[model samples]
Target: MTTISQTAGYTDLQTALKVRARNPALDRLRCFLTLVVLLHHSVIAYTYFGHTDPKSWIGFDAIILSTDSFFMATFFFLSGLFIWPSLAHKEPWIFLRDRLLRLGLPLAIAALTIIPIAYYAIALRRAPHISFADFWWTTVTVGPWPSGPVWFISVLLAFDLAASTLHRLSPKLVDPINRLSLRGYERPAVFFVFMLIVTAIVYIPARVYFGASRWFEFGPLSLQSSRVLLYPVYFFIGAGVGAANFDRGLLSADGRLAKSNWAWIIAAMIPYCLLWVLIYMKREILGNPVWLPDWYEIIYGLLFAAFSAAILFAILAYFLRFKRLGSSMLDPMQAAAYGMFLVHDPIVLWLQYWLFDVDMPAIAKALIVFVLTVLLSWGATAALLKIPGATRVL
Candidate 1:
């Protein structure tokens, strides 16, 4: 029943989707997020809430709060954007193999090697004389096996597995979301509101029940309890957006979503400011309770969810708006970004440990750590990529 013209249209759409899938804008965004991750860790030690050294800055607390609210969730969304297309192209077994090789292998390798090395700096601060062997044994064998940032990797692999199973059962499961994405082409605010509601629904209850600081942890496997469902919401929504017709959907470079960057910036700033107001209330008005009331948790959670959604849209729009200007500063690190993410924790940690005793102001120490961590991690990733057959995994 298909006409020649119809077939041609379909083919053209497919080609466009392929091009969009490989969009430089998305790559640049991922690289920017990676840098944000580095910046986040670089400054956390200096934050008022998490001060591990003599110097502490309230400014870093604001930065941490904003970054923590959005970055990992956005990373999951980006990871999901490519999943359905990848699955459509490869055999199930091949897809599984690739996911395992890329995600599983890194997780296993990092948990054993990189994680212990990074945590050793923290351990050294406490015991100062504790041997690496002793620290490693206690960490791996005894308890509190910290995964650092690679928890995201482990959880992502699990989501990929779940997605594979769902795809096998019904490829159309996400069709409704894809349809909504198409609608987003004209009215991105609709899509934004949808994501805000969904993320808030999933995130708020768990946050109120589990509180913010709780993590479900077991020997190198850990996740923030509240985010367990929140991340999957973002991931599956991204999958829906990317399920098909990626080039023509909400993220189309020419779409209103791209043109509406400023709207989202305003949207993001409102909730972000409100979040700080709540923070002030928690500390100044509520006496900084050990556990905030459920009402406080609910309101904070909603604001966090709103801010996250708006910022995601804003960042995506910013990139898409400038996507045609061609190669970016972020381009140079595109290939190495993943490797940089995997390896940056230890570099940042050790750099902080070295700078811990320095008499510099908090901002000075943080900048020194941030600049050095970026250079070192980039160099480390570049060197790693030179290894034979490393590109496939890195």
Candidate 2:
């Protein structure tokens, strides 16, 4: 018979082992990314409420671009990082089932519950005369027109499903992609050139013909198309990194490579920030429609994206190096961040409509909305996590 204290000690040790198995750095990254998403949505809310002109709001515009494209790219990459190992370790059917339960269920819930609320709110505010049936029909058949942020969930589910199918058919295909490397003197330059060409080819045509809005549209029940070909690239990159055991050397305190990695990150940001400023100036000065020439947008967009990715990875690397900061109370908030992402837009829209008549500066109104939305969204997610089905998807 084991003593009670001994059993308690064994349980504690088991818990510690379980946590050590998972990546704390990834948890921190998730938390930071959630804040990025929050900031992005806050700025968009400000724009929606006519607090600032879309053209002139340089900081806000930069945040929007970085958040919309870069963060999602990173998310996919991180997802891919974890996914390949899990897939390689588990049976195919089990992996598929888990993906469906995790990705598919959330998507179904978003479409059925969250999106309908968005449409209802919009209809009430913008077109009150429209019946609920009309709103429902439009959302179901046409879309919530401009779909909410949860659009990422649906799109990612598609990617996962596709990747899983391919993996099942040809597990060998991923092996080569997983093995791609930059071994030569000019490899980094070659990689950059390849990325540039790919970005131009994908984004240029899409921007020139389809327009920016159309490129990101969520077509009813069929596809969520976008000019962002780099999402798949990021996912595969994550998979490759996992396959190669690419740990963040700089993230460790005693690591020798820290300084060089930090320098690379900072150097990357200079071009990114400059590109953002240039794009902001062009948009503000020219007052051109959002759908401008693909060439310029593609070039600048890629530059900004590279910068964003570098900065994000660097920040994570640095934080991971200093273990003291990793144990913050805010860590759980990161886990709750995805849930907040799914729900924040509807909350923002409702709050904006409710406060439309309030006498306040546009910035003040925006701040209020941001604070309230973050609190409410975080709380909603926290509560949902306690419920079994909600946690299953969330």
Give the top-scoring candidate (TM-score): 1
Highest-scoring model, lDDT: 1
Give lDDT per model, in order: 0.84, 0.56
The C-alpha local distance difference test score for the whole of candidate 1 amounts to 0.84
* Per-residue alpha-carbon lDDT of candidate 2 for residues 1-394, written as tens digits (9 for 90 to 100): 0000001111111122211255565566666666666666555645522343222243554556546545666676666655555655667787678667765676677767786776586578668788877887777776645445655665566666776776678665555444332221123333334444554565455545655455444453322244456566666655554443334322333333233456646756786777757666666875756656666666665565556456545554455554545486557675576677777777777777776677666567667777888899899989888997665556
Write down the TM-score of every candidate: 0.95, 0.78
Which regions of candidate 2 fall more than 4 Å away from where they truly are?
1-20, 48-58, 129-134, 141-146, 169-209, 216-228, 244-265, 284-291, 322-326
Instruction: Point out the worst 10-residue segment of candidate 1 by lDDT.
Output: 1-10
TM-score of structure candidate 2: 0.78
lDDT of 1 at 116: 96
